[model samples]
Target chain A: MSHPGADRVRDVARLAGRSARSKRRSFLAEGPQAVREALRRHRSGTPTVEQVFATDEALARHPELAEPTDGVTLRRVTADVLAAMSDTVTPQGVVAVCRMLDVGLDDVLAGSPRLIAVLCQVRDPGNAGTVLRAADSAGADAVILTHGSVDLYNPKAVRSTVGSLFHLPVVLGVPFADLAVRLREAGVAVLAADGHGDADLDALQDASAARRLAGSAPDDEGTGPRLEAPTAWLFGNEAHGLAEEELTAADARVRVPVYGAAESLNVGTAATVCLYASARAQRR
Target chain B: MSHPGADRVRDVARLAGRSARSKRRSFLAEGPQAVREALRRHRSGTPTVEQVFATDEALARHPELAEPTDGVTLRRVTADVLAAMSDTVTPQGVVAVCRMLDVGLDDVLAGSPRLIAVLCQVRDPGNAGTVLRAADSAGADAVILTHGSVDLYNPKAVRSTVGSLFHLPVVLGVPFADLAVRLREAGVAVLAADGHGDADLDALQDASAARRLAGSAPDDEGTGPRLEAPTAWLFGNEAHGLAEEELTAADARVRVPVYGAAESLNVGTAATVCLYASARAQRR
Candidate 1:
């Protein structure tokens, strides 16, 4: 192990921005959580990790981070080198450079996923990352970010996800129609999470429960699909909600009913609720 | 209406920092969402607003921004002055200076609350504000932040709340023990949202429904009060969860089961799921 040369440090720091990461075809995963997950994925034949830089203390603390195979490299550096390559105000002593992990819409669809999050034009990096984390927690098969959405590899977005990005398949740069048609053809009903939708989330949950209890499947009119059925949730941007064309493409537009004085929950929190609801219903 | 003097601009900008805000006894609520909510609260006589600064364009677009009552001043400023007074990179053409709105825990308890969110040592302004917005959306009567939590009036926290801060009572700086006792005296059952808790949220929801079907109140062994019962949800910090002592004080410690590869949802998203579960159960 040796201290990173000045040129190497400068090159790594360029990854703190989107353009460099895009051009290099790699991103930096900072801190222990993200680096740990990236290494895990890299070890599991993903080839996502390019190189890992850690201080002696950090390497001693997380020895598992040193485990890499087949072209993966680990280097020890002073704390200053780690900080220079990190985007956060405080560096966590470990940073992993990784190739992008996003797959194509076809790859995601080929899996016949049960639950997917289709984020359309979501601009906030933190929100996008939070939704990815929520989708992973809810056992979603994949997350598809339509065009105009925030860059999934943006440093802020990567950090916000903690490690969930490495835990799930994320599809980037897909068009709205491609996602809609592919999901529908896969028999995954697309539902729009609209604030002003006609369908109520609670009533849908109750109906699905009743159907399950009766030992039958949902065959109701105007209810679209039962909660237990394969589903794709379409979430829009933070400010202007789902476009009229986007909602029109959905099987049903459903709103998470607001019980209090708050106008509406933010996009990330709202998606979390919807994903959790679907997870609970499918389990039942 | 007139331009804000240079000194006034400097004073308002100082509110962006914690020490200055503490000294001035006021905070800046930047952007249209926050300013609108502050004005709404002011109009209702809660009188949280101190003064509002807006550009003529902003005023024309949102005529309601000019409707403050007696003793409230509306100043028209250049976009430059507005940006100077705002904490955001791009000022939204409006900013509201307001007194802190957090109330005493005793006041929140006196409201005979059915649902409440108790945040324990939660840091991260974005997470705190999202929890506030979630609690408000779930129709919680109030929110309580224990000692060691992030300041509720931190500019980042206020902006993340997206106007939900004015929708309900938020109690800050309460000791854990004091909050525990007051909630008990108010007949509210405290449930700790612990990741490793014994109780499962889905099972609890089903058991509550089962008890409802039995046509009797909650009296089951091991399962504490039904979720429909008046309750408070205790959430811990982002990195370290609730302390052992805090968990012991709760009636039941419940975990939101993770069905996917994600280890756990972030605290903010987890809180949203818990709050929505309670809101749905109460409605049923």
Candidate 2:
């Protein structure tokens, strides 16, 4: 059915805000990439997507969605209604109402994850999403958003992930201290990614490579933990980095070396480089 | 001189758009970071910053600008006037009008540059700014924007650079074909960063490292050109990557290997990784 300017449609649009999204226990997956991922996850029994709302043109573009599914309710929306339901200046023709994707912290940790990205108090929606995407690309097993992070389900953050939210486990609203303990209990080394950290990232890579060449055992140089160790990377806010307590709490603090004159690397790009370095080391 | 909603302020606000900025030969450097960078360049004789408009509160925050400068004109404005002249949702209370910062291609290429970033048809302001910041951090000598890329002077693009624009020479509006010829003649290897390229980034790194280990020479294993050579990374647009001709014209197309299911790296992040790899190789 086509809902043109209905209250129900407007209510869905209001989910873009935090309180409304919390009350509704749902979030929007805007654009083709997000909607496709939501649908794919739902069909595979994850049950993220509850409904798909699209303009006729959007549906025509995504012909594969025409095949009927058991759980998802597909609806046709008028262009006006689609506009009303959009959070962006130019709404993509498709939007999916997906259930909250964040899993329990305990559940995520229980899965024996080798790599996890912990975002602590990260404020930028775009940066948060980019980290999630980077973590997924680096084969991170899970992502955790501690208290004070931008809402995991924020439309912009969701869009930024490019559907990585659906690909991996994301645990939300966990206390950083508690999460760190759990990671330790699981034999994962918690590494704080900070600019001030004494352990250089290149040195970490070299140490891991040396260990591999020396027959799979980390040496005793005290250059911080080996990348081959099961690890959780804790990243902090944009302006103010991780609190001193947060840094102290980690098994070690590792810094991505800046080879050029730029003072510091962006949080998103730094997270990507660190994650990839770890992935490369662990895979070897 | 509080020009709350004056015609002059309105005209200045209009400079946020491309046509108006091009016509006026001035663009906005908004917020403390961007405005500071522009003024720094101006005092160093680069003459990019022409005027500064600020609220009393903004001027108080920046004590360095309290004293009058030789060239920059400072005007006090009401908060409302500052808001009128601002583009962001939250005005940082300061804005500067900067002259065109782009240099001629011939001028940039004449500097005997070792590393450069060439953007081809890149459209997103955030991505473009990010690439600028990344290139700067990687210690690139210059950045060239080929025709069809987003406006370098666009306010959003400038904001995204986080003041990196001031730190490096940026050349704009050069035709791609002419740029390729100039780069080749300059002994600068042009490498197209593509996902389907024959040369893998890891393989390239290994080859460069191997050559260095074997004593100061590039190996001829046919993987691709050595990164230590003067290199210009040509990054394509977000939506459509480099065209076949563009990719074919490069010395070789080098792909950043993806370890996870992420279809590709973001254009900005990909450019950062490529530039840093080259920077690291050259540094070695």
Tens-digit lDDT string for candidate 2 (A1-284) = 56545688878889899899999899998988888888888888888888888888888988766557778888888777887898976666888888997889878878888999999999999999989988888889999988988998988898899988898899888877667888999989999999988888877775665565556445455456889889999999998989877888899889887765567788887888889878877886
Model 1 clash pairs? none
* TM-score of model number 2: 0.94
Model 1 Cα lDDT, one tens digit per residue, B1-284: 58668899999999988999888889989888788888888888888888889999998998888775666788999898898888888767999889988898878888899999999999999889999999999999999999999998888899889999999999988888767777888999999999999989988877665555555755554446578889999999998899988999998999988989987768898899999989988876
Per-candidate TM equals 0.95, 0.94
Off by over 4 Å in 1: A68-70, A217-223, B211-222
Clashes of 1: 0
Residue-level error in angstroms, candidate 2, position A126: 0.9
Looking at model 2, the pairs that clash are none
lDDT of 2 at A15: 84
**Candidate whose lDDT is highest:** 1
lDDT of 1 at A275: 94
Please tell me what DockQ candidate 1 reaches: 0.76
